[model samples]
Target: MNPYFARSRNDRLAVGTFLFGTLLAVWYLMCVVLPHYQLSSDYVIYAHYATMTILYFQSLANFVMVTVARPDGNCKALQRNQQTESAHCDACGIVKPPRSHHCKVCDVCVLKRDHHCWFAGCCVGLRNHRHFVVMLTYLWLAAVYGNVLQWTFVGDQLGGHGPATWFRIVAPHVALLTGHVTAYQFFVAVMTFVGLLCLVMFSWLLQMQVVQIYHGQTQHERETAVTKYDLGWRQNVTCALGSRWYLVWISPWIPSPIPDDGYEYRTSAKTD
Candidate 1:
C-alpha cells in the first residue's frame, strides 16, 4: 500500500478516537457536570468553559500553523550560506543542512530534525518547532484540564453499586451487553478513562519536548546526548521559539521570528 494510504488508514484510529472522545466529553459535561457545577456557582461554569474554549481554539490554531509551516530543510538557502558541512540525502536528493536529516515517513529532509510525530503526522523540524512545542503545551493543558474536570465532576456519577464501576471500567461493552450498566453509564466510564489515558500520554510527550527545548537539542540529539548546540536554557528557548519568546510564550498566534537561519546554530562552549 502507498505510504499515504497506510498513514491515512492508521490515523483514522486517532481521528475517530478524538472525535468520539470530544463528543462524549461535551455530552457528559453539558448533561452531567454542568448542572453540578451550576448549582455551586455560575461564574465557575462561565470561567471554566471560557478557558476551555480558548484552549481549544488556540490548540486548533497551533495545529493549523504547525501543519502549514512544514519544517522542511532549506537546502537552497543552506547552499548559499555554506555555514557547515552538508550531507546529500539520496532519498530527498538534496544536500541537507548540518543537524538536518531526512524523514522516510515525511519523504523530506527536515532542519534540526526532532522526529516524525505519529500524532501530528509530520516531521517536526526548524520552522515549525516553535509551533509544535506551543501546540504540545496547549494540548497537554487541555488534556490535564479535561481529566481533572471529568474525574472530579463526574466521579460520583459512574456506578453507584458494588463493583459496577470497576466492571464498566474493565469492560464497558461487556457490562452493557450483560445489562449491568446503562448506555449512558458506559459512555461516562469509557470517556473518563480515555481522558486519563490522554493526560498520561500528553504529559510524557510534553515533558520530553520541554527538556529537549531547554537543552537546545532535538530528539535525536537528546538520545545520543549531543551537546554541540546545548546553549543556555534561555538561548536554547529563543533559538527554538524566537527572540520575542518572552512575549509569545503563552500562545502561538503572536509572532516571534527565530533569530538565525536554521542552516547554522549558535554552538555551546561545552561542545567547542
Candidate 2:
C-alpha cells in the first residue's frame, strides 16, 4: 500500500496504453492504408496485415497479463510455523520463501523476485516472468515486421526517382510540411525509424533473457552470482517459461503450467 507502489502501477498502465496504441496505429497505416493507396500489386501486404494484427493482439494480451499479475509475497500461509527455510521480511513482518526478495518500489517481498520493470509497471517475479518474456518476443517480432513493411513502402515511393529523392521529399516536410509526399508517406518514414529503434533495444533485452534462462539465473541472482537453482537447461527453461514452453511465443492464451508451485523449487548445490 505504499504510495510509490501505487504510482508505479499507474505509470506502467499508461506506458502499456501508449505502446499498444502507437504500434496499432503504425500497423494500420503501413499494412492497410498505404498498400491500398498505392494499389500494391504484391500480395504480401495482405499476409502481413493478418500476421501483424495477430502479433499486436498477442503482445498486448501478454503485456496486460504481466502488468496485473502480482508476485506471491510473504503471505499468511507461509508465515505459519513451517519447517521450510525462509527469511523474515522486516518491512512486511512476514516470512519470505527461498529466492523471494524485497522489492523496494513495490514495498513487498516477491517470490523469485527478478526486478521491477518500469515499462510493465510491475515486478518481474515468479508469477508473471513468462508473460513478460513472451510479450517481449511478440513485440520484437512486431517491430521487425513493421520495419520491413515500411522499408518496402519507402522503396516503392522512391522507385525510378533514385535514393536522392528521399531527401527531396523529406527535407521539405521537415521545414514546411509541404512536399510531393502525402501524410501516409511521412507516417511510414516515422514508423520505420521507430521500428528500427525498437528492434535494436528489444533484441538486446531478448538476448539477455535467453542467456539468463540458459544459465538458470534471474536478473537478481545473476547480479549476486547465485546459481543454486542451476537445473539443466531444459528444466530451467520449463521453470521459467512453463510446461507449454514451445507454444508460449505463438500465443499468450496458451496454458503454460509452471513446473513447481512458486514456494518450492528444486535446486542444485553448485553455484555458478
Q: Return the top candidate by lDDT.
A: 2
Q: Pairing residues by index, what is the TM-score of model 1?
A: 0.85
Where's the lowest-lDDT run of ten residues in candidate 2?
Answer: 1-10
Q: What is the C-alpha lDDT of each candidate?
A: 0.72, 0.73
> Considering only N, C-alpha and C atoms within 3 Å, which residue pairs clash in candidate 1?
none
Q: Could you give candidate 1's per-residue lDDT for residues 106-217 as a string of tens digits? A: 6667788888765555667787788878877877888877777766555576645347676677677887898876888787777766777777888899899989989889
Tell me the tens digit of each residue's lDDT in model 2 across 34-131.
66456565676576667767887888898878877767543675566254588788897777777888887777778788888777776888888999
lDDT (C-alpha) at residue 234 in model 1:
90
Q: lDDT at 71 for candidate 2?
A: 76
Model 1 segments more than 4 A misplaced: 1-28, 73-75, 78-84, 160-167
* Model 1: residue 38 alpha-carbon error in angstroms: 3.9
